[model samples]
Target: MHAPVPGHVPADRVFAFNIYGDPRLTEDVQASYQSLHRDAPEIFYSPLNGGHWMITRYEHIFDIVKDYEHFSVREMQIPRIENPPVFIPLSLDPPTNLPYRQALMPHFSPKAVSAMEPKLRAFAADFIDEVLARGECDFVHDIAARFPVSVFMELMGMPLDRLRDFRALADDYFKARTNEEIGALGERIIGLMTELVELRQKEPADDLISKMIEFQVDGRPIALGELQSMLFVMFLGGMDTVTNVASYTYRHLAQDDALQARLAADASLIPRFVEEGIRSFGVINTPRLVVKDCERFGVQFREGDMVLCVLPLGSRDDRRFENSAEFDIDRQALTHLTFSSGPHLCLGHNLARMEIRILTEEWIKRIPRFSLKPGLRHHSRVGTVIAIESLPIQWPV
Candidate 1:
């Protein structure tokens, strides 16, 4: 039951923006995010997606994310879910969430990500090599889509041969038009994960699945159901985040010759470029369940309403970062909530940075200059994680 929305929030604030189905989400998402903070308050109610509160400012978002007791991450779905799948660490609160996060931390820390750089670079180079001679190719398919999926498959102990097939399924899963379609894809993904899990039980390898098999939470063996949920989160994240990030970032770079040339001449600046790119173009509106009645940020949040913490808008808040709209690599405050904040901060952040950095370094090194094919704009869809449709580009042979 929703407590009455405070009288302060006006009916005009009910903007009909649907993050999942909006075409503008992929086209000019930056402008779209800015519109939230344009004339609206820090938080507003959007009746779209069956009614939810949209958090528009960085300070407000940070507060709610830090206090999970009031704003629970358990129900992350936009439209919300009944008996949602419990994604460990991500879905749990406080002490219970710590151990699961700890078990996975070592693999994604800076040290581990650094160690994997060589292989990651090789993967990036090989992907770039495939399309260098063509002078024009779909950057999404040739590099952005495949490279991360390859690494994701390795990390999860899935077969590399299924890379192409998995990409197709992931695209469908994120862009599904109906609930039944989403359900079918979910079952298929879970089935594959189940097969991998069962295989690891009999024959463990030196992969994440093997480690999960050996991990114990709460001083006891992790439950199968819990383990599956963790894998499910990994499955969604692994295939989604970097794919859109790389496509969008590189697509931007492709169009900006001066920026591309600058990065090409001095590769050391690639990290800053990655940070700025994420800060500028990051897309992902995370949802949290209102566990109980509470008035936060001068807004009345009820027990059952969903609060969407729009990170892209929050990170770019001018109060936090001056000149927040423009992508300035040398910006004094480059930090952002692109991966989110607090206990639920993304553990995959280091790995994601590594992927984007390597791909940028290698792509610029090979094809130092490129641009979108004539008038072609890369396509994308807004959903779970915004999926980049295609990034076709051309350069001098």
Candidate 2:
């Protein structure tokens, strides 16, 4: 049911888009978003989720993300919660966010990600080997989900034995329905992270957490709250985003025999394929809180309003790209907002790209020809992030 549209939202600009529970999403996530581009106003206010604005066009989203002065990252959740869980740097703006972001840059830099390529490649190979003999596997559970989590575990120096438990928490966090439910899950996550923070405090291992603990932010020692918040964002991104990206990319490849064969034949094409796949399957739908009264894009904005930048839609904007919806690896000047734009642009994008690229190269090398398992359908859970719930895929032995 739609909430009452606020007076500021013009009658023509209101759309009943529930980002969390939209039924059409399960049918075809990309198609549903494409329909919005073809049908809805460029900037419409969805009455659901506490009456927030949805920015559809790439031009508008790019501007809003950069204009943090008007569109604050603080209190980003739709249906705006009271005392929402802090995600640090993610939830901070400008000079304050810059320090923490800078502290993290070196670790996720292209060079840093390149140095870890050998180990990452090994992980990809081992994961594929585990499922190769079966000739069929639920790729999301058996590989896509585990690969990135394992990489995160190694980086954070977390015990591999707890992989399943941690993965479960990450999954639950995304699936949560209400503010109360989300808050509870947040506490559980923070509790788990707190244990790791305390452990690094005493032992001081050579893990990412240990290095972060030692680094000074803005000429001052990082406080405990700031540390946990930063760790939370890292854990959230590291554990979840790439997993969904991999699943969606592979699912696409499974259907496109020609595309799969081309990539397998020429490994050099995998990087471009990865970029195009990211563009085609962009996952995140991030929210920005309006800090002050403003007006733009033929609409009026009130202070404290929530604006959701539909990244997937923006990347698929027809005006921005020729043939925007199709996943064409040969597409030139590929600039998609899958990693977002501006100061709050995704910090872990380098790591995410490397992980997906290595995984694709290894998968195509081992299993050149594969497809979605016959008689099975794929479904995705749409919330802050769009995630494939399960992906059953098979190949001949």
lDDT string, candidate 1, 130-152, tens digits: 88999998988888889988888
- TM-scores of all models? 0.94, 0.98
TM-score of 1: 0.94
What does candidate 2's lDDT look like per residue over 82-168, in tens digits? 888778999898967999999999998999989999999999999999999999999999999899899999999888889889888
Which ten residues in a row are the worst by lDDT in model 1? 1-10
Number of the top TM-score candidate: 2
**Candidate 2, which ten residues in sequence have the lowest lDDT sum?**
23-32
